[model samples]
Target chain A: MTRTTYRWAALFLALPLAVYIAFVVFPLLSSFYYSLTDWNGFDVNYNFVGLANFEKMFSDRLFSNAIGNTLIWTVAAIIVPTGGGLALALVLHERGIFANIYKSMFYLPIALALAVIGQIWLWIYQPNWGLINATLRNIGLENLAQAWLAKPQFALLAVILAWSWQQTALSMVIFLAGLTAIPQELIEAAHIDGANYFQRVRRVIVPLLAPASVVVIALAVINSLKSFDVLYVMTRGGPFHSSDNLAMFMYNESFQKYNMGYGSAIAVVLFLITLAVIAVYFRQSAQVERLYD
Target chain B: MTKTIAHNDRRAATASLASDRAQSSRVPMIIFYVLLTIIVLMYSAPSIGVLLASLKSTAEIAEVGVWAIPRSFELTNYVEAWNGGNAGIYIRNSFFVTIPATIISISLGVLAGYTLSKLKFRGSNALFIFFVAGLFFPPQIALIPLFRLFNDLGLYDTLWSLILIHIAFGIPICTLILKNFFAAVPTAIREAAIIDGANEWQILTRLMLPLSLPALAVLTTLQFTWIWNDFLWPVILIRSDEMRTVMVGLASLKGQYSVAYGVQSAMAVYASIPTLLVFVFFQRYFIRGLTFGSVKG
Candidate 1:
């Protein structure tokens, strides 16, 4: 009976496992192999590069810029959305008149495709005739008006801020759920103990909300690192390639430039960097121990 | 004695009802409303812009903010987008890829999640850990190899190729979610089913599966929204115009690189309608799903 059941379980698992290995595992391993060789994607003949691709990568200014942009986006993305979401969640968790409406509304932006969000932001950031500059002029802050996306200094920051608005909704939902799980009795107890609102939030609520924060922050970092659509649509790494992230760089190098070996090398670097970051996060936070336990 | 018991029940009900009313009128109520309104406006800005833009003509959009009410409301953009822009075909391709991928991921996810959660098996922990690690590896890292592999297999530029790729990457998160849900199911129920001589498959299909409807509903709605809005995979995998999903179609429609704001905005609205409709219909399920996983803490 036990043997039969084990066989049944194996049967259930086999197909997905096989498919995953074929598409996911094998491709990744092969990519790593190709990263060491000098193979143009469309080329008929190629030779082993022996880390020459990687050696060239160290001096590549554009590659470094992409990495910097990715890190900046990751940090800013996590901080802004997580912070904003916490405030929204706290307000809504108090059970106001339009609590449900607020949640549904905040969630609206997330439902639209990234393509749409990118296009909308593009219109908003138009240099002269755009909504933003027009609004600034109308508000008597004429000096504040500038070319938002066209200017190299503000372009990536503008894009990141736009991305944050949509993401905060998800983070808010997570935090709201976290808030609800805290027993009302405990909050009342804290109040009775003379804890002010800010104190209560800091000492009691935030600690209780740690798990949700972990999930939201981890996801935010990963998503920001992987963000491609908005960057691709709005700027295509324009303004002298100031807005490019690792993913965009990978795509541009591989498909646009036809440098398969170099692209694979960059990808391998990204893959390793992501792994290292996650490992460091886990190690520093000791989050995994608490999360699984 | 019966009168005393009935009298106590009446008193208890009234007391509970009064407390519920008291909680509603708490001091936090006013602050909640104002904050919610502000946050909601911020969230809906982009979608609202798209809707208004889609209703205006190209010429009007260039002249005014997308949020402006058109002097003459022109809903013709929607018509043009659907018929002339081939949005109909793009939307069709989206559904074709999405439905099959959703079905495969959910079914496989539920099975794998249940097995990992309830059943004892060798290599289970290692496999689970392996998948969890896979979650953090950016898909871009595998793009070149996957593309080449798909090309070699003659699966490039097809919806099946895209669906298969979606399912592969989707498995980890889906399985993780379902496992979390399945673990919440009571052990006693499984013990009872086992006592009845039900096989593993029978117990899964007839007993556990039926009880998991809420979680499955949540998964379905979430999967539909996610798979529907996906852009990167489709852009990378499918090159044919007819094979392009709605997101990619709208993306490529950007006229002369950056000047198609009017038509692109129109296409954005068109692409959003289906998912927005799904969102409106399944708002409760979607909310419950997003919150449910968090609430278990």
Candidate 2:
């Protein structure tokens, strides 16, 4: 490239690059530094604690519970949404007026903020007058009614259900796009070969949808790992911290408790987990792309 | 003669079977529609409940379930929700943060995305990858340090803190989308513009940008929705009640008015309207932005 071209490019890139480095990169590096020290966020005379924070995390029950809950959240978040979305996509992929309306209705939750969704679910899970319990009573199945978000056993599951509701819309949309991309001739050929509806789906549709599934699964996994807003809004990892995930644990520890070093350690761990997931996702997606090629 | 008769009989049997199959398919089709209706109702229950509850008095909400239509519409719930508390200020704060953040991020994203796509300087690929990698970094990692950094910079309790954070976080996806978008514009257009004595600035502003209107719309809507719906940054950065975004305000409203489900529901409805409007009006672009970002990346 010529010198003027070079100068123009530099000018174009200067502001974004500077802002990115300042806000994103600088904080990331600072988190790494803070993770190893005993800084209380305000005190400058804090000691270098080395790996003590990381070591302490292993012995901390709350940290362990957070890890476990995070895993549960991630697994459920992936499976429920992917499976439900795929089913919805299959059912709704056909063109019709009703199908279009159903698509919009299913996608309605996507537009609402997570905080709002959480609050809505929170009210829905209220014990006395909430929708679930009231519906249970109206149906004469009052025995099934329980405090969905208050009980330790049910809180995490309740939050996951809400997350699933919001997440499935995006998954459905992606899978619908994937389904649309499939050539009509393939399905027609399958039908001409005497393949039934289930047979056609199994042979032609599902296999071809692997790429969309990869994208959905990757997004679901990453989103679950970073799950915070809904949980924070609904239960705040309440009823004995049973619903707390790693993100909540980090936030509570760092911001709430002001344990800067420990929170940074938790942040580092969460980052590593996310990085690992992204790496796996990239590798899997690359393979999927190769298959298409 | 017997062979001809047999062939005619087989044809008749096949026609009968085809008719049977067609008739039988109608049953499943009916079942499918029924199932779809149930699913739609189930999916829409919460939103419907919230909307209805927002229109009901507190006593009505308590007396009857959210499923029941209010005997009298309490339109005052919305008025009260708006004027009663900090909900108005919080929503205004969200707009203050969302609008400028959207404009700034999209502007920078266009410039940077255009440069990275067309300029092809050394390390451009690496820089692109760097920005894309930002997508994977969980915001929790940045929270504590960003808090301290903003505090040190005296932006801790201000709306600018959330604005800057949103812009910084928004760059990756915005730039990625814009880069892909600009790349799709054929090189011939740029070459012709250059031959016609247009500079890079003029080419981008006058020639390329108009062509990229769809992508720009997608980016603006997506970024606006994201920044508007953002919860974490506002919770961390803005301490004052007046500076809080809608999500943060709604969350706090949940605690403050735990007993008054009517007002809380009203606030929920109020908070959802802007993003909901975007979704309704720009539904195609919204879905396109989502699928494009995920599938292409």
Candidate 3:
């Protein structure tokens, strides 16, 4: 408010601004520049290839596969986590036996790193004597159980399931918080108006949970788009890159194959998609801000 | 704001409607229980199996199915993981990185958040957006540039690389949390303090900081967990076994000890324990932080 305070403001803001610009803002802009060159991470004397990297992605089969897998993950991200979280939040919204413990049990995965989650599910999907096969044999459906992560057809889906385990927990917690904000009187009012349970939930609860859904769905979309760690730990985008999303694809291209330029192109594409989704998130969340106050 | 949400949820959970038809409630209640049972099993079964398998030899796990009870408890699995598997060093490196990073980031974030919240200086909105925009950008976009930059600084393999990177990247959420929080405190107190000749720094350190401990707790728990569990940057940046975070070490262990299932499981448990402690003790703060940061509650 005063001249001296304005000086303090500058002092306080200076450090964070410098660090943020150095680490994040500068590098992010540089990624676009680097994407246009043929830098293989070692040579200081690479040519500026001017959109060649982006053009190469047009015909790359593995790039196509990565996009396909990303589509699957993004679609699954929209449906599975949203559905599971909403269901759990609704169920947990009502009191039950050991409700607190159940809530913790589900939320526990969210705390663990995706790497750990990948390991746990790796054991669960191990071909021989693993949990899936063991249970399948016990139930006399041994044919149904196989190496879930090894099969190219199943590799991406298996990894998606493991990631969904953690993400679903996140969604559930957000929805539970959303559920708290709903007025019970609205639900009760509908209940007394001859509306069935499903009708009341459909008309009152779900609609009112709009703010939470925006957040949960936005998170799911972003998390799925950033499908690197879990896939890295689980499959390494393996069984011949069947599980490769843009991140894994980029890593494999840049780090493993030493194609940093192409990887940067992929990164640019991934960044653009994420930027669009986040822009939408900002708009929708603006509405949620209005709804709150 | 967070208090009302928690309070309202408690009431919602405990105060079920009495006017509901018994028949209408019963079917879905049964369905809910069934789904809950399935979900509980889905969440717990793999973990329980991993725990069981971790207590036995790989040979023994193969002899009996992984879901089978261990014939003998091999507590040595943890030792093997800790020493033979190098989890001990990984854990040390993680703590060395996570603790300093968390403390430094929170302090810097508070400074930025306080100024951005109350100072009303020119270009403050742009500065705030500068940090907030970081939240939207994917880490991949910065990978090549960052890798080269770190090498240039000669901090490539050292822990400082991660500590600085985390604090810089963590600015966005940290500022958002504290800014939203400090903004909520009555401006009259700030005005009063100003009239008393108290400076901005004094008001923040004495008045705002003490009043905003809850927000700090939320930021602390969330930031600590996130930095501790981070994998992408660590894997790319750290080289020596001595410098790898526990998550990167776990990934390496999986490659080196793929046949040693028991050891792998033990290391997985070791990797998850710290975050589990955060979850166990700060469950309330953890959930609240998640909502407040993302949903801006």
In terms of lDDT, which candidate is strongest? 2
DockQ of each: 0.53, 0.63, 0.63
After superposing candidate 3 on the true structure, give the runs of residues whose Cα lies further than 4 Å from its correct spot: A286-293, B1-35, B293-297
Show the colliding residue pairs in model 1: none
The fnat of each candidate, in order, is: 0.66, 0.76, 0.74
In candidate 1, which residue ranges exceed 4 Å CA deviation? A284-293, B1-39, B187-197, B256-262, B291-296
Superposed by TM-score, candidate 3 places the C-alpha of residue A40 at a distance from the truth, in angstroms, of: 1.1
Q: For every candidate, what is the interface RMSD in angstroms?
A: 2.9, 2.6, 2.4
* RMSD of each predicted structure: 4.3, 4.3, 4.3
Residue range B143-258, candidate 1, lDDT tens digits: 88898888888999999888998788777777777777788899798889888988889988998899889888888888888888888888788888999999998887765325
**Cα deviation of A62, candidate 2, in Å:** 1.0
Give model 2's TM-score versus the native structure.
Answer: 0.95
Docking class of 2: medium
User: For candidate 1, what is the interface RMSD?
Assistant: 2.9
Query: In candidate 3, how many Å is residue A176 off?
Result: 0.1
Top candidate (TM-score): 2
